[model samples]
Target: MAHIIMIHGSWSGGWMWDRVIPILTAAGHSAEAPTLLGADPGGSRFPSRPLTAWADQIAARVREAKGPVVLVGQSRGGLVISEVAERVPERVGYLVYAGAFLLPDGASLGGTIQSAHPGAEPIFSVDTATGMTTVLPEALERIYSKTPVRWIEYARAMQCLEPLAAITTPISVSDERFGSVPRAYIEATEDQVMPLSLQRAMQARLPCNPVFAIESDHVLPSSAPEELARHLVEIANRVDHPARLRRPVL
Candidate 1:
């Protein structure tokens, strides 16, 4: 069974995957959802950290796993997984991007989002003093567009400020390393935070095999946990890790 590492994006913590993890475990796959350095509720207690720190945190997990593990990144966590694969490719069995930023080398999340929604008002307001970016509580409406009211409220309560430095940090990956690892994508079709057009654009550019689409918003954990869990398991079932690859059996 594949051990799935679930990385949360901006303003979110490991708690985001609480609903999804149990289902994954029930299906006989182990899962981990880690809160980024500055994305936890007590995140503000510490100073803002850099992208390498986040990538380092995950790479350690990959190295410590019993075998090569699947890296499943959601939202900005995609970059972290990509960086991890680049650094320790052999330790990574598969890479899965869920409603995430699948940017090429040298692309920063902030720049891509800015470029995508050109001339639009900023979704996050920056705290120049602390290098933190916070979403207006109201913006949860757009980010979790299709989610129920209770989930949104939970998200609002759990969400914290994200580090500006992390989003602005451009990733460095190479074909020989990061590219060698097998990868897939899970598209959140109705995402307002990262629009469907942008999702398709990234898929076209990067081109992951066996792209899976979900009719949900950006926050799939809250909106479509079971569906997301199913797709993840299906993707995990396909990769054999350093051995011959096997196509998913139905």
Candidate 2:
């Protein structure tokens, strides 16, 4: 069974994965969805942290795992997971991007998003006085209309600002170390936040093609946990099955 490290996107804590974790555990896989710094509602009451700090948190988890782990990143969390893979590729079994933001070397997450799709609204808005940033609730309607209403409400309630500047900075991963690890991407067909065209475009940037697609919105793991879990399991099974040198055509 593969050990998995799950990360949630902007304005969300690990709670976002609550629905999906059970499906993975029931299937005999071990997974951990730790809230990012400044994200956990009940954790330490410290000041907000930076993106690399969040990436460092995940790296620590990867280092502590008993064996190689599959890193699952959703939305902005995808950026963090990729950075972790770049830094500690030897400990990572696979890098799974779920409606994730995939960046090239030396690219900042914000800059990459701006370059990839111009005219998109900032996912996080900042308040200079307190140095806190929060995601706008209106954006959720655009991003997660297909998602359950309650889940959206919960996400909005937990919407805290991340250090946007810090998150956008480029990070490094050794090519010799991480280049060969298996990778998977899950496309949310109805995702308005990251459109299907963008999702396909992001998948194209990956070294290998992704293994599955769910015709739901951005919150597929919460909206359709069982289905998402099934796809994840399929990708996990392919760990032993040799990867096809050629990419699969959707």
Candidate 3:
């Protein structure tokens, strides 16, 4: 069994993975879902941190986990996992990107998102003075298109403002570090937030083995929890033999 470290996207906390965590535990894998700095609405106020520092928080968890460690990131959390793998590649057994921004080294999430949809209206409203950002209400429908209405209300109530610095910070990784780790991608096929074409482009730029696809929107955890958990368990089952194929394929 592997210890899975689940990282949530912007405006979301560790609680975002609540739907999928129990299934992973029932499958015999342990899971740790941590809220990134400055993203917890109900917790103590925290100073905004750069993307790398956010990654360091997860890396610290990896150091404490026993057995194999699998790092999974959703949406903006993808950048967090990338940097963690760079800092502690030997400890991380695998990396999973679930409807996430699997950016290449030196890319920032803000830049990638803008480039992905040129001339498109902004999806977020940034408060420059406070250095925080919140999703525009009109864009909510696209983000949670496949999510059930029952969960959508609760999710929006819990959603919090995310730090802008984390989105604008660029990441740097070495081949000997993050590149040495085995990785996989869980494509949300119908994702409008990070559309399928953009997902494919990222995988092409930074290839990972055993690409798996799911027919869900951006928030797969809430919309397709069972399927998400099943894929995660499948990855856990292959922990011992995950690195044999480095090229991503169906």
Candidate 4:
């Protein structure tokens, strides 16, 4: 059994991992989903908090874990986990990026997204005054279109503003530390929020072994919870018990 940490992306909290957490727990693995600072609802908002703060929050969680953890990050949370792995690589068993931004050193999330879509901003609504960004209601349709309507509603209700600085700040990860850790990437072929082409492009730059593809939207946790959970378990099993690596992929 491996300790798993689920880190959600921008405008989302630990609640996003609700489905997968139960599945992992049932399998007798320890799993935790931590809401990144400023992403939690009904809490103090700090728009100026840098991306390093988000990474530090996760690193702290990793430090508290019983053993090396399988860190799974979705969307913008990928950046946070990447930094966490860099800060405490010894504590991370594997770094999994599920339809996430696996950026290289010295890259910023905002710049990468801007480059991918150019002038087309499909989901985010930035508030310059508060230096925060929130997801547009209409974008929910794009994000969780494959998910049930009730799940979509729940996600919309839980949405919160994310600090703009967290996305704008570039991160520095060393090859000596972050690179030494094993990594995996899950490609959401039908993702609307982050285009499939962009997802493939990011993975091309930071290649991960045993890349898995799923026919789901950006919100895999809600859209394909069982499938996502199975994939995570497969990765964990392969990492923890090498004998399972030879098992046929489902």
Candidate 5:
């Protein structure tokens, strides 16, 4: 069984993966989604927390696991996992980017987004005084277009403010470490938040083997949890027991 660690993106907590965890566990794989620092709504808001702290949190969890782990990052969580893999490359078996930011060294989330879609900022309100960024309820439909309306309503109620530092901070990764690990990318075809064009551009820069695509929006874990779990499982299996092509015997 593979140890799967799921990291959520900006403006989201570990609870985002609630639907996918059970499916993975039932399939005989151990999965855990830990809330990243500065992400929990009820917890303290440490706006000064750097991106490294976020990555360190995940690396710590990976060290606590019994064996090597398959790290899956969604959206901004991709940046966190990339740093985690850099820190503990030996402990990670596979790196999966589920429609996430596959950035290179010295790239900040904000910088990358702006580069891809100029003048495009997060669909949220930032309180400069408090250093907290909040999502408006009305924008839920735009953020999660493919999700059920009922689920969107539920998410709107549970959503919390995200730290501005986490999104603006630039991450550093090395080719010898983060780039050496096996990786896969799952593309959300109908993603409104991160357009399919940008998703393809990011993946092209940091290519993944056996890339998979799903006809869902940005909130894939909630909208298409089963399909997401299936792709993850497939990647895990391929990593664990790679298929071999046999040569014909004359």
Candidate 6:
């Protein structure tokens, strides 16, 4: 079984993976889902820190794995994985992006979103004293058509957003490190935050043709856990034995 590390995006924490973790573990794979820094919305004890600091935390998790891990990033966690891969590509076998950011060189989270669709509100807002940005309720409400009541409660619980300044800074990536690593992109067909066209466009930048489409919304793990689990397991199995090709033959 592959060791998988799951990273949550802005305004969310490790709790976001609660539904999927059981599935992965029951299937015999060891899985970890860590909340990013400044994203503990529920009064959890998370040290307020920068994006790079969060990347470092993930790298530490990767280092503790038994073997090379399958790093999975959701939403802005995509940016976290990109940075982690650069730091420890040897420890990462496959980078699985679930409706996450797959940015070009020298792009920040803010810049990437702005470049594609301008005048959008930042994914999060800040707490001046803590310098932590929490997710804006209005944004979440707008993104989800009928977000579960529990999720809204969770959002209320752990609602810190990333600071705009940190989000706008270009993340450092070396082509030498990120170029050779295998990549998988799970594009959400009905995603409101990330347009399908943009996901397709990002595919062009990956090293290999990623798993292109998953019929769901931005919140795949929550909205369609079983279907998402199937795709994730398939990708894990494919990485284990590259010779055993699973892509549908047209």
In terms of TM-score, which candidate is strongest?
A: 3
Each prediction's TM-score versus the true structure: 0.93, 0.87, 0.94, 0.93, 0.93, 0.86
Question: In order, how many clashes per candidate?
Answer: 0, 3, 0, 0, 0, 10
In candidate 3, what are the lDDT values of residues 146-167, reduced to their tens digit? 9998788878888888778878
lDDT of 6 by residue, 1-250 (tens): 7898998876667887888888887877788887766565455445434667888989999999996588888888888898898999887878888988887668887777777889755545667886556666667754553357676566566555556555666777777776556788888888878877777777766533457677666767766677777777877776667665333211
The CA lDDT at 66 in model 3 is: 92
Say what the RMSD of model 5 is: 4.2
In model 1, the number of clashes is 0
Looking at candidate 5, the ten consecutive residues that score lowest on lDDT are 241-250
Per-residue CA lDDT of candidate 5, range 1-250, in tens?
7899999977788889999999988987899999887667777655366578888888999999985589999998999899999999888888899989888899988888888888775588889997778887667787899998888877877787787777788889988899888888899999988899998998777877768999989878988999999999887765565342121111
- Candidate 1, residue 119: the lDDT equals 75
Q: Rate the local accuracy (lDDT) of all candidates.
A: 0.83, 0.73, 0.86, 0.84, 0.84, 0.73
Give the Cα-based TM-score of candidate 3 against the true structure.
Answer: 0.94
Report the C-alpha lDDT of model 2 over 106-146, residue by residue, as the tens digit.
76766766776798876567778755566676677876777
User: Which portions of model 4 miss their true places by more than 4 Å?
Assistant: 242-250
Which run of 10 residues does model 4 get worst, by summed lDDT?
241-250
Candidate 1: clashing pairs of residues:
none
Indicate the residue-level lDDT of 40 in model 2: 71
lDDT for model 5: 0.84
Looking at model 1, report the run of 10 residues with the lowest lDDT sum: 241-250
Model 3's alpha-carbon lDDT is 0.86
Model 1 misses residue 112 by how many Å?
0.8
